[model samples]
Target: MKNIILATTALVATAGVAAADVSISGYARFGATYSDNADDWNTASRLRLQFDVSTETDGGIVFGARQRFQTEENLSTGGATDPNNSNGARFYMSTNGFTLAMGNILGVIEAAPNLYLPTASSGMGLEGNGFYSLAANTSSNGGRFAWTAYDSAGAGAVEGVEVLYSMNGFGAHIHSTEYSYGVGANYTFSGYTVAVAYEEWDAAAPGGQVDGDSILFASIGGTIGAFDVALAYASTEFSGVEADKWSLKGGYDFGTGLTVYGFVASEDVVDESYGIGASYDLGGGVSLEGGITQTDEALDDTIVSLGAFFSF
Candidate 1:
């Protein structure tokens, strides 16, 4: 009975106060991406508009929904075509410190706020270069990526369920599907936080697709005075094989609208990789960003990009 409260009594307490909220926010970016492997530069761009709707009734209960209409070009192939457009949706009900969500649910591992690098694409360059910095989604290291995430590709969203709870300095989340599930929790204090997450899936059999069987992840991060830093590690097992990856990154703000960040990552199956980036604020919902990432594989892969971002 730790989080027990009568809904009827909550309704009686608020008595006739009904309010609703709606907001639209998104960003657009365009620029050029350069890959050493391609030996040329290509146009990179994306436009995303998010709609959020919420309503609160007499009770202390609130219901909400969110959807994003995103049109993004395929930057990896050096082609500027918006073929993987997305219109995913997520609905939720919340009260106290708990929220229950369904439809295009945010996977536990994917929802960790401080897990990814603080950049325009959460990685490097104009389009994230695949968000290769993350630990759970090991595709960057030639491993299978099977974590549940908010489906943002036009291939249609995955129907799933999740629950997120946060109170004080502690938070927890759980996500589930027909074949996969994950749970995670974090605690924060004095500008520092520690988090751990685990997930498992069973999609193996005769002629079946073998995804991630299990994964364990951990991270510690915070802002220390003028510098923000984080270190993360992940171990995964899939198809009877096990591998691990780790990342270390940091950022600094010069108080003059200019911020710089750098990162290094290593995985058991691949060579070491690193990246450096910077962003400058130009005021009025606009900014300039640029970055270069070097990934070590069979041959050295480098991605570089610069662009302007507009938000509304």
Candidate 2:
């Protein structure tokens, strides 16, 4: 991420010193993706720019807002598609260790610590290659599942609110929407961390009618001597049926700007899925990445992708 600092400070009668600034950062990737089903390699690419503006009140409170502009190629279709409703905003205020956020709120389930692998992209390949390691994403492997989360695709966005508090090694969040609610907590000790989250959706919720209902996710991940490792599990329920799944992920940093990571997962009904990947940091906020993934969605179905990722 690159920093573009702006403007300066003001003194108020009520509080200490107040500062204001705006920062810009985002990432981009371009590469090729291949799968057995596609029978051909397809060019894939994405670009994103994010603006973050913030000001501190004289009373020691902080207010911030974030917005993004993004365009991405549709690797599955071998073309680009509209991102629909180019604007979605998240706003919040924080003081001490507590924060109150509204508008495009981050879901507690999605914010839980250790829930994602400690990789450059947090999953396989450049675009995450379906992010099957995410226990909340039960649907990608052919199971019924859904959870509340920030809209990353620029789709209008869920009108929601959330509360977040973090201090020391403990963190917690609560999120609510028109038809869904979620809660999660985490704690870190020594070099290890544990986290858990739960979310439920009413029938009227977007995916509730199909796989919403409720979902519980838990994970434990952190540094392990020479390696970083994590394990995650989730249970989802819909209508009268229930299913569960688990995943184990790990990575090793070689101190030479190169990292290797991978995961294996098992799910009820869906069976098994796995992937392995490596990334080389080239300095100047850029990296080269590649991965190979196997899924149970079909017989011998696999994905191979390579790309260069940039942040600025």
Candidate 3:
């Protein structure tokens, strides 16, 4: 499998040399995860290869496309499968401060500027799954938050368009789909970035009527001395139902290739959750990371993960 990946990488890089720039990069990680609720230890790993290509046209417009091939190692099978599909392909055209993208594009809210988590491991064990509550036709699953502006990579090829513009430390994004639309803007000044976004989805409910749901998000991030800090808030509304969530994250860099970070969050339906973690740069595109997280809803429920990440 490793040899196959290497050969494919070489082939991809060699095929795009004619009047274009091509880059091949990827990430991989292997880790051990422990859950107190399950009382078991599990292994998790993921590999992703990114193919990026771009060229400047005669008219000075930049044209580009990107695709990612990913494989998640399943512990049950002890193997991974790389499916050849175009679900992750995205094309773009850009010049000056404006850019246009289509096909598997990110929604404005999902692409909001400076939106990130400081955790070394995936936060909350939900990975944004239970992060918000929006009205939709899908099963409620016991009333947990379960809606997002857009689906993540390899979600089986969606069609959308995104337009973005940036100038003088300010940027705006707009994305539209058949049933959903979003818009956002951000500005950076004095080492701080502030952004806000809103998105709405028209979902199909019973009786052939459309149910509208929306989300609003705001975030701010900046640096203070050796500490980096970020705060965010989100509110969702649908069918006279309203919910809100907020989180605060901070990280401190020791200037010695080691950093520590932590965060706390509160949501309307879920108990408050918090985590602390640290990462060390091993150099040469490798890093060591680990974290521990807990939620107050469970009895002795905690998750701990230790992982090594490789990037190239």
Q: What order do you get sorting by TM-score, best first?
A: 2, 1, 3
TM-score of model number 2:
0.88
List model 1 lDDT by residue over 1-312, tens digit each: 113335434543665648989999999899888889889988877788888999887766787899877777753422223454655689887889998887889887777756688877777755666455676546432322356667655443456788899999999999887667889999999999999988777664221225667778899999988799999998877676677888888899999999898888888877777888888999988989888988757447888888998889
Q: In order, what lDDT does every prediction score?
A: 0.75, 0.75, 0.63
For model 3, the superposed segments whose C-alpha errors exceed 4 Å read: 1-19, 74-86, 118-153, 205-210, 238-241, 296-300
Candidate 2 Cα misplacement greater than 4 A, ranges: 1-17, 75-81, 140-145, 208-212, 298-300
Model 2 error, position 107 (Å): 0.2
Give the C-alpha miss distance for residue 244 in model 1, angstroms. 0.8
| Poorest stretch of ten by lDDT in candidate 3 | 132-141
Residue 173, model 2: Cα distance from true site in angstroms: 0.6
Q: What is the lDDT of candidate 1?
A: 0.75
lDDT of 2 by residue, 142-188 (tens): 32224666665565367788888899989999888887888899999
Kindly list the per-residue Cα lDDT of model 3 for residues 196-281, writing each as its tens digit: 98877776422122357777778889999999888887776666466676777778999999888777767664566677777888
Clashing pairs in 1: none
